[model samples]
Target: MALWKHLVQAASAITLAAAFTSVASAQETVNIGYTGPLSGGAALYGKNTLVGLEMAAKEINEAGGFEVGGKKYKFNIVALDDKYSPSEAAVNAKRLKSQNNTPMVFTPHSGGAFAIQAFNEQDNFILGAYTSVPNMTERGNKLTLRIPPSFAGYVQPFINVEMKAFGKKLAMAGGDHDYAKAWAQLFGPAWKQAGGEIVAENPMSYNKDTDFYSGVSRVLAANPDVLFVGGASEPTALVAKQARELGFKGGFVVMDQAKLDEMAAVVGGMDMLEGSVGVLPLIYDKRPGTEAFIAKFKKLYDRNPGTEASYHYSTLNAVSEAMKLAGTVSDPKAIHAKLSEAYGKLPPERNPARITSVDDRGGTNANIVVGMVKNGKVETIEAASLGQ
Candidate 1:
């Protein structure tokens, strides 16, 4: 009897240990990757995006992470600084895919996003973020997910509104970056479509360019009724300031990169940004859902968020929603399908005013809001009426 009792106790202990091990093994973690220029001229852009991403992740985790297959797993973020280099972005993307096995990556800029998209197309993972270039999604890459309205979609309204107000002749200036080139190419065709003419188009190299005298001189000589500055904060601001100094007193159309605060800082104040038009909506206007996000962002970072930052934040939320819908994050195919479904099912409160649904190619049908920089802030000039 003593021996039998000892054997029974041993069996009980073994069964309990096995059950505990199974439970622990069932708990998994979902890792997400973020790649961008954490250090460089675009560092601020990357930093703001990171802040929003982190905020979203924290909130999700605090809410008991995410549920999948009746099991709960915490979400983790693995961020790498690509320093705004395409080659570095490719390398980081490969690492995330092979080494870390990350399910999705959030890229804020065009160059980095493009590089990752190239690899993700083959790997069957998800690449989500805001990139204005339509080609990023137009090529039918099954993995690429864009958050913003394409430059082609957003620029038309801008042209109609500005051309009617300022005249037909237009001058275009942009950073010599890949994204700016893409924007320039798109704008040229779109401007012509809208009964406008591009009198001159010039490209300026970024980082190595601090002086816009030569480019501004050429633009001023063209004497366009309106000027379009395409690039990130600093370069666009420099071009705008120099154009004004050179006595080209005309309305300006800033591109997606020129956020309200950065433009104001570059032009010395809100007065300089006054009358400048851009593609993003006024996010700080204390709208119902937006006010909470803006308030949280400011409370955490003590600064207003930009388009890039907001897009990144939304991407995080969308990812969480996708995971919940799919009930698993390990399978990229399942997650991708779930993302499409979740986007359609998203409540009005969770959806952005622009994007209605995620298309088959993972592209969101997001509309654009045309706004003017006034009093050092972006104010909505017109809500984009799609197909107009």
Candidate 2:
């Protein structure tokens, strides 16, 4: 009787082990690629973008992963640092496609996105572009997906507000990077068209130069009513602080690359950011799903999620949904076609940016919330009315 009881216990243990193995065998991994500035002046921005993708992947895995083509799949993000260089980004894309066979590669900067666009179709991977540059989708790349709405929508509203509050004269003191340069180019002509004068144009290297006093002072010498300055949040804050130190008490038209909330953190508070206009930071978003997403993000990372983090998180979730709808995890064309449908299918909680549709050119349409620093507080001056 003792021998029989021992044999029965051994049999039960074997059955449990087999069940665990079976469950493990049923799950498969799907690789996704992220190439951006993991180190350098733009490191924080890149890290924020990566965390968003990682957070979404984590949530999807915790929910037992999504199913596609009759197989259960979990996500594995293969990340590489490009140091914010377009050439390095191109190299990383080749490696990701050759080694991991990733169906998609996300890049935060416009330069890197354009670099990838040159060859993403040939390599059969989708370019998950995070840039708001209108040309990102306009060039007709089949597998390209522009996560954020075009920055073109901000020009008119910015002109309306700044030209009214400040004066007709504007000075350009933004970063010299490709993204900032594009912004300055757009703003300069638009500001002129709106009956404003470009008193000065001084582009600074916001990434490399810590001392923006020279550039800021140069722009201030023009005695402009509004200073157009922005880059990454840190350096942009420095530029604004120095302008204030120099007694330039006028309004500011901040480029969208530099977040107002992050700039405020660096320069002390919202009081320092009075009369600034830019994208509405996710923390100030009163949309229905934004609060819950922020709460979840804070619980996970122990800090507030910015527009970069929230947008990427929601975009990644939409991509995963697109995969399921396309019925395959590896086909870029199918997933691209289904993206619009998939975006509408997401539960509101999973979509903090509130993406509504994907157009034929692969650009997303959403409520581009714009905010302004008015009387020491960030207020939503425009929402849903623009970027539709």
Candidate 3:
């Protein structure tokens, strides 16, 4: 009787162990790849993007993961640093696709996006491009998703605001990166079209050069009323600071890549950023979605979130929702097709930028808010008012 009782207990224990194993195996992991400048001058920018992606992934997993085709799956971000190099981005994409079978890859900078775009459709992975450059989505890569609305709309408004405040003699002093080059090219002609004159153009390496005295001096020598400057936020701030030190008392046309608030942090205060125009600082946005996102992000990161964090965070959440709507986690094409529906499902609290929909070519659409520093405060310049 004692032997029979012991055998019954052992069988019950074995059954329980098998049940635990089955439960563990039920939820699978889906790898999502990210390749950006995680270890270079733009490390902060890259880290912000990664933080947003990871934060959203953690939230999804904590809520029991998303389900598709009657199976549950959680996201696992497979992040690799490309040091802001386009060639390295391409290599990372190949590795992510071959090894992890990631259905999507996110790249923050336009250079990396363009490089990956060259082969992303071929690799069957969606490109979560975080660039504002209009051409990124215009190329028509079927699997690409432009996270931020195009900077194209900003050109007219930017020229209008800066030209109104400062004289029309524009001097180019932005970074030499692909993104900045594109912005300069776009702005130069537009500045001319808007009845502005191009006085001087000087492109310097924002990442490599520390003392921009020579470059800024050259641009300042042109006696232009407005300086076109941008790169990553920190370096851009340094350039602006150096220009101020050189006695440049003109307005600035800042590119959308560098956040004005972040630059203010580096340059002491908004006093230094006075007369500068760029993308509106996220903190200034009074939308309920923006406020909720900032609160949640601050709780997690212990600091204010910028456009980099907000945009990437919303993009990741939207992508996850797309997977659920498409009812497949592995098919990039299907997922891309469902993005519009996915964005619609995002609640107000989840969609910080309040992106309503994506265009047919893949770019996300929303009102572009332009901010200008006046009296040491960021004042909103509605895109509608600017005729964007």
TM-score of every candidate relative to the true structure: 0.87, 0.89, 0.89
lDDT of each: 0.74, 0.89, 0.89
Please give the TM-score that candidate 1 achieves against the real structure: 0.87
Predictions ranked by TM-score, top down?
3, 2, 1
Which window of 10 residues has the lowest lDDT sum in candidate 3?
A: 21-30
Q: Which parts of model 1 are misplaced by more than 4 Å?
A: 1-26, 281-285, 347-354, 374-377, 385-387
- Superposed Cα RMSD, model 1: 3.5
Candidate with the greatest TM-score versus the true structure = 3
Select the stronger candidate by lDDT from 1 and 3. Answer: 3
lDDT of 2 by residue, 1-388 (tens): 9999999999999999999978766447788999999998779889999998999999999999888888888899999999999999999999999998899999998889999998999999999999999999999899999999889878888777788888999999999998898898899999999899999999999889999888888999999999999888899999999999999988889888889998999999987779998888899998779999999999998999988888888888998899999998888999899999988888878999888889999999886778889999988966445322
Q: Where is the poorest 10-residue window by lDDT in model 1?
A: 346-355
Candidate 3 local Cα displacement, residue 277, angstroms = 0.3
